[model samples]
Target: MPQSHPRPYGTLAVVGAAALGVVLAACSGGGPAPKASDLSSADRAKVSTGGTLRWALDAEPTTLNTFQADATPDTALLAEAVLPTLFTLDQHADATPDPDYLTGVEQTSQQPQTIVYHLNPKAVWSDGKPLSAADFAAQWQALNGRSSAYWTARTDGYDSISSVSQGAGPHDVKVVFAKPYAAWKGLFTPLYPAAATGTADAFNDGSRTRLAADSGPFTLSGLKDLKALDGAAVTAVRNPHWWGAPAKLDAIAFTPAAPDTRLAALRAGKLDVADLSRAVEDGTPVAQAASVPGTVLHRASAPAFLQLTLNGGSGPLADPDLRRAVAQAVDRTAIAEAVLKPLGLPVLPLGNHLVMADQHGYEDDSSALAPGADNATRHLDAAGWHLAAAPAGDAAHRAPAAAPVRTKDGRPLGLTLLIRTGSAEDVQVAKLLTDQLGRIGVPLRTVTVAGDSFFADHVAAGSFDLALFSWPAAAFPVADELPLYAKPAVQPDGSLNNGQNLSATGTDEVDQLLAKAAAALDPSEAARLTTEADTRIWQEAPSLPLFQRPQLVAVRTGVANAGAFGFTAPHFQDLGFTGH
Candidate 1:
């Protein structure tokens, strides 16, 4: 669990207003213009000499493959070096499908459901093999047939895709759907080679380590065990045969740093870039680090969501009022102010929509559920729980009903909250939440488990009452929320069912709206249906959204022109050394 950090609103507002004013003034011809050749010889010298950029990551890559499972930030960082998508998400957060490898399909009157793509003429794999439409066809088939669990969200709109075929010409691919899909453009991500689709098992056997073969700017020279060198780090060198503008850095080493050690390494000048986790940002470290000259701190609005998920089985949480009470009890502002602001980050208001504002289909119209001490008490009261003031000598406490939901029956409402004890931040968050819930008279107990065991068995097995977890933003759309909440979708196998429906919420209206939204070709109709679905989810309160965690990138002051791509932090290609 990442620690919560609140951004200083007053300071941020002043700075942001000043920056906006400068931009507005510039547009109105207020600032002086600069001439060309502003670059100094010393600066040019630094840019010409490529060197290894050391970046400290928070975690290790679980799997090298991105398509097989939801890739973590660490996994994504490594994958970007080896695998290049058909189109990149731009700085403005729009998916600009690469014209070289992907082209828009024109819908003729006769072929209303057809999409055609054109591969770049120069595009070739790291192995010098030509990438063709057949590779994409094979990848699509593999995703729909073999890795349905992982591909369901990406291919939700494409369920109507009848067939994928290669065009008559080289590097051309055509896909024909049973019906029109408004989000048809989302299918243009990186595809696997045709060779891997011989069998489902063969494709997912984890033997595709060298699938690192792509047209990306960099390729895996070798998977050097960074853990062996210094626990959980991997060094990726630039690919000589890359098709795009070659990466400026010769090699980028990704080192896994714990929350406490990340800033220390940054201050010591050993690390060129560091991801400021929530724990460090809320602490005194961010202020200390930002005070240093030549160091710049950049924060991006992430689409990620951290939520408190309830188990929907015939448990104590099976009650809707109790869930609502818990949702109201959570102090999102406190979490943001105490956790986020100190780190120089902004807190996102709580709302029904799980998708971040930057992502498509996000509806900002939904109001966040407010938090209050009285509101918590009222919700608990409505749920048939009463808070009894503590007797003389003890800490103020809520009296436990002889029976859980005492108003309904005499039973203990005690429930276990399964949390991962892997990181220090996780433990801290769980403690904070436990204390808060305790004040509201919720008899919640903390059960800390190892990471692998928790996800592998407990979460999948549906053995816990409440779980605190986070979901990373995918390039897919709102329709992805369906499988997460749909009841029949949860499989007996240990794979994730639906992300948004983590609590196994069973709502027919939500399901109908989501299904309609998926099939509708009109953006307006789809947005309406999705918004309706979000409304129902919020009302039901299966999962209580915590806050949108901020992603921090700390770079040396000498790194020039470093920029972030989409919501994901800055890429290695955007970074360059500017010091002589």
Candidate 2:
């Protein structure tokens, strides 16, 4: 999912951070490299019970439904606590059946690509209804993109399902795909109850504010059930009917606040955990938080990476040659250094758009589009964009003021870049990009929009020539990322459905390769097909990868099984306080 920040897909709350000084010291050869995940791993026996965890949220979720178009990362954060998923990702990014929700899962037939999910007999919703196949069937019908009534965010794997039915028992769900779908495990995550998805009206609006039922370790805590806190937005209490390991914390309270204000709350002991990812903009809070008693910092490469999205739907970028020129004009290495250096993380520019550098199947397919002003100028010149007349001077002694400007057919080569209003990361990237593009004789101006409306109103709406944002990396890359690069299709009603491809760029070849990759059962075959598609994406210049953003989190020392979870989904039941 494309978001303003690089939050991991399907991840719960970020745990905490290691001391800023420690991370700097490590980077400066005072210690070893950072680990994949820095959460204080501990066995269940070591975790103490009976404490409320005060978690900070970037924003209050506009909708509780993760499948809705308006749903943000905050919505997914809340859903992880109260909803059930068929599978969860481990530290290695491998999908494992969540035993609490699924007893077992087996492929029944390869002909129609049938799969049978054995649900946990003890699993039941908060309304005392047993978890059954009906929920899966209803959810599939709502999100398979077969009807116009339901508005789903993405229908990658679900759209491949031909039918979802009950097996021999009520707790068994049998899913039959019309085509072979390799990323079957990604479907029905955070499954909704049948009651919510039974109708188009309820599926769209019922979970917008509150959930009708839940089947996870925590249940949505009602306002009347507990006293209100000063700034908390929502709260979740331990589910009494949870059949698996009970929740370690008595309750989890979500308090919404800006990134810069969270550290102050943490210092005042109001917030138990706070994300410090924004420390790249200002290292002051990170250094200052290290002195706070019982505070620790942890950092890791976030699953998501920042990228420069070029809108190819219209404007000067509608020409593929100009898009390539824009891509070559970007100095990815310099941009990564500007953002990651302050956070004490290695500055390595990402090469592939489909997969992160740390993820499996990652390969540098970015060799074709090298970043340099010379390359940009060459491409622009080849596209018939010539330099405008400058003040005559000795070629060797020309002043910076006499730098060449690109023009074609009496029009100057200029573009508008859209970014979030208060995002320091976006502003910093924009500043560096402005300088980079200017050197190539192109004028790039930035338009700042409200953070809340950045994606819905601008990026997704194709209202800008360029946009800077991050996409949350999914465990199932081939299936999850297909929409981000797939070509926009004109509907029968003459409307364009771009899905999640904010760049408005794609090729039929790329789409065919992605489709083959999605259906490739062999891991090697899938990897090869995905790499081929990524290479085409680079040539098309839809987006240029910058680098993997670091997930920096600060927390009290006693917090365990939390913080900087790189790719693993946090186990809420395993999260608790340990007496220090």
Per TM-score, the best of the predicted structures is 2
Global Cα lDDT for candidate 1:
0.56
Error of 1 at 320 (Å): 1.8
Model 2, 188-224: lDDT tens digits are 8888999888889888887677777888898993633
Candidate 1 at residue 53, lDDT? 77
Q: How many backbone clashes does candidate 1 have?
A: 20
Pairs clashing within candidate 2: 15-563, 16-553, 16-563, 17-297, 17-298, 17-553, 17-554, 18-297, 18-298, 19-297
- Tens digits of lDDT, candidate 1, 1-580: 1101111111110000000000000111122211101111123335644887787766665445444443345655666566646655543234556654555444442245676777776777776877776776666666554454332213434355677887767777778877655456555354555664435654565323444355566666566332344364677788788766667778877877765676778777878776554544335455665554556666655445566778775477777777767767766556645655665555554454434455544554333344565786787787777654433433355554332222345554567888766545456667777777766667678898876566556766667888876654434445445566675355678543544345766677877876776666555666667667777777666776666555555667676545223343344454567654
> How many angstroms is residue 132 displaced in model 2 relative to the true structure, after the best TM-score fit?
1.5
How well does each candidate superpose onto the true structure, as a TM-score? 0.76, 0.86
